[model samples]
Target: MIKTASKRYINNFKGFSREIWILAIVTLINRAGTMVLPFLSKYLKEDLHFSLGEVGWIMVSFGCGSMLGSWLGGKLADKVGFYKIMIFSLFTSGLMFFGLQYITSFWGLCFGMFAIMTVADMFRPAMFVSVGAYATPETRTRAMTLIRLAVNLGFGLGPAVGGLIIMAIGYKGLFWVDGATCITAIVIFWIMVKEKTKSPYIDKKHPDEILTHSVLHDKPFWIFLFTCFATAMIFFQLFTTLPLYHHDQFGLTEFQTGLFMTTNGVMIFFLEMPLVSVFERKNVHKVKIILAGSILMAVAFFVLMLDFWIGSLIISLLLLTVGEMFAFPFSNAFAIGRAPKGHEGRYMALYTMSFSLAHITSSKIGMEIIDRFGYRANWLFMGILGIIAALAALYLYNFLHREPKKT
Candidate 1:
């Protein structure tokens, strides 16, 4: 039975092309080296002596840069191919990281972070485009799962090592390692993957029947994008208000809070790909799956409203993790599936941009709710947002099914 389970787990990772594997490896390398972000706020506050408000502005600048980068990456990928954008983003961002450590002044650091993030985040949509180009329709969701697993694994590894580096060589070492990793990941990618001007793989099943002529006109996709946005807002609570709630309410130490997040990462690494495989194998509609995830996430928040019990936190986290496992990979695949040939970069950019925008707003909104109405209010608010997202997904599912398929 153990052997059977192991074989099934391994099989889920099979059938991916060599390029997909290479891309995953590069992503893993880059993400693992991403030790700078988690510590950025602390570094700015403690090391640079920046005030809290100043740090907030810098972070807002960073978000703005990220949003612009995402849009540019998508637009440029369609114009010049994903290969060039990926290479340029990584290489330039690496150099920027090395210099960012030198910018100690508030304004200098703010501009530096904005510029670096603008260049760095361009890689996201381009990489999504690359995944679509590399994987088939049947395997695309799983392929995205592989990429997410790599990301989770990298995030899991990055912080522990980053802490050690900070203790040994200080924050400067983090900058060096982060920069080096970006450059190293891209170098390996350049060596392993040959650049192509066009998508090598084609979806022969729907060659002429793209859902909409222009992305702007894709009404169902707009609803789908809102679903993505709402889900992200709820998820970002894990990083933002949820941590504070753990500390203030349950008396969880930073270390204990870290463990809760680790649980999330570990679950995603081990379970997400296989779960996606199961859903794909069953021929489940992506929007239906997403709607289910939305409900789960809503319930996860509502579970937290049971503040009388500490175990509610664990249960809520598990539900949230499973919901994330359901929503994110399929969302990626659905976004790609919606795009017409040669327009995938644009579609993916918009999808990624939603997350970026959510990251900017989720913390502010959650924190305000906590300040004004308390943690229970925040949970209720998030739960309601999740339900709204689920409703949007349901609407999208019905909308797509009702649209006449053009053969």
Candidate 2:
């Protein structure tokens, strides 16, 4: 029995092409070196001496850049190819962050943040395209999960180390380290990874191609996009407001908040692939999977609403982790599943823009809510939004896929 279980588990990592692993490695290095977003809120308020309102506006600028960049990346990836896009994004974005560290003026800093987000976000759509290009349809979801696993693994390291770096050196150290890691990842990808001329999933039994659908006209996708936007609006508070909550409410230091973020990365790293392997089977309804994740997200903030302390915070983090594990991979797979053969980048770009949309509003909206109401009020609102969004998603899922047994 033990051997059978072990075999199935090990097989989860098998069947992927070599190129997918290379992508995973690059993703790992890039994510591991990520230092800025987690600390950006703190840096703005404390280091730059910006008011919370200013922070909201700056994040909105970042959001606008991210939105445009994502759209551009997707459109360009179809025309130019994913490899070149990624290479340019990683190397250039890394260089830009170093300059970001030195900027002190409000307009200057806003412009710098906008530029960084624009460049950095291009990598996402390109990576998704690369994932689809490299893996067979049979193995594609697992391939996606494998890369996600790598990302989370790096995320696990980045923030914890970031906290320590903040202590050892300071915020400046974070930017330098972030730049170095991005460059390192770019080098690995450039050296080892090559562009696959074609996708591996062309076969009689399961054709990978789909009818090309317009993003605006596709009803299902639009529904999914709205769902993504809503969930991210609440979920992104982790980056924008939750860190501030940890500091202002509990009086936790930067290290402590970073340490809290580490739990998020750790849980996803250990649980995501395994859960996908065991439960996210070929026939499982992606909508059902997404709805389940959304509910857990609600529970996360609900836990926080009930109490505000170390224990509640830990529980909330765990719930949010599990929610992400469920939501992100499946949601991504669904988007990829819907795309036409050559336009995966565009479809994913639109999907990814959902989060970027949240970035535009989540910060400003959250900061406003917290500033006007109390932290508990903000938590309650988040919790309520979570439930409503998930329920709406559930309804949309059933509406979109009328057939029960369909993937």
Candidate 3:
């Protein structure tokens, strides 16, 4: 039984195909590079002597650039190939990372952030489009689940490793390390992955098909997109409000905080694929999973309001991880499943935009609430919003599950 299980696991990874593995490796490396961001605000405030609001604005700039890049990446993926676009984005973003060390003024730093985010966002739609191209419908969700697992694993290791790097050499060392990783990822992708076929959205004879596949006209797609936006708002707040609450209310050290963040990724690494497979076989409704995730996430935040206790925080992390395991993969699967055939690039791009939009909006809202009412109020508000997101997911699922009108 042990040998059989090990064989099955090996086959599953091999079955993802070489292209999928390449993309997964690239994702892991790129995510590892982004480890700088979690500590970026602190780096700016202490090492660079920037104000809190200025730091927030710099983050907003990055978010805006990412949104714009994702919007454009879809079109580029359809027009050019995903591999080419991704390689270019990775290399350019690497250069931008190293360039940050040279920027002196606040505006220059903002521009650097914007440029880096734009290049980073370029990877999202291209990667999603490649996933769609690589996997059959039967394996698509599982493939994406594996990819998410890779991302989380990278997330788990990147910051912890980055923390050590920062302690040894400072923020400049962080940028240099990320840049080197990005360059290595680019070379690996260029050598190992080849674009095998044109995007389904783009026809060789009928070039006009590209112009016609607009996702905006699909009502059901828009419903799913809105749900994505709502959930993402709650999700992004985890990085911002959750950590601040832990620090201000509970007084956790940076190491303790890192552990709190790492717990989410660890859960994803262990539980994501098994959960996906279990749900794949059951008669369980996808929307219910999403709702359950939202409720658990909200409950986790609400639990934080309890008096400072290490046990509570650990429990809360477990709850949040459960919520993430349910919501994120299912949401990605549902979006790709519902997309109009041949428009996966466009659909996934819009789906990814929800995250960028959520980050921008949540940061602003969180900052305002944190400034006025305090961390508890901010977390409570996010928890309430998460519940609303749950309702939205239910509404969307029912709407999609309904019968279509006869032509």
Number of clashing residue pairs in every model? 0, 0, 0
Q: Write the number of the candidate with greater lDDT, choosing between 2 and 3.
A: 2
Per-residue lDDT of model 3, residues 302-333, tens digit only: 88777566677887778888888888888787
- For candidate 2, what is the lDDT? 0.82
TM-score versus the correct structure, for each prediction: 0.98, 0.86, 0.88
TM-score-sorted candidate list, best first: 1, 3, 2
Model 2 lDDT per residue over 1-407, tens place? 99987776687788888889989998998998997777888989998899988987887788788998898888888888888989999999999878888899899888988888889989999898888888877677778899888877887778779989999999999999999889899999889887764465633245334443476676667777877887888888888799998888788997898778777766776577778876646567777888888888888988887554678998989888888888888888878777766777888899889988877788778888899997888888888887887887887777765633233
Specify the highest-lDDT model's number: 1
Cα lDDT tens digits, model 1, 304-391, are: 9999899999999999999999999999988887888778889889999999999999999999999999999999999999999999
Better of 2 and 3 by TM-score: 3
List the candidate 1 regions with Cα displacement exceeding 4 Å.
Answer: 207-209
- Give the Cα-based TM-score of candidate 1 against the true structure: 0.98
TM-score preference between candidates 1 and 3, better one: 1
Error of 3 at 38 (Å): 2.8
Worst 10 residues of 3 by lDDT: 203-212
Clashing residue pairs for model 2: none
Residue 383's lDDT in candidate 3:
82
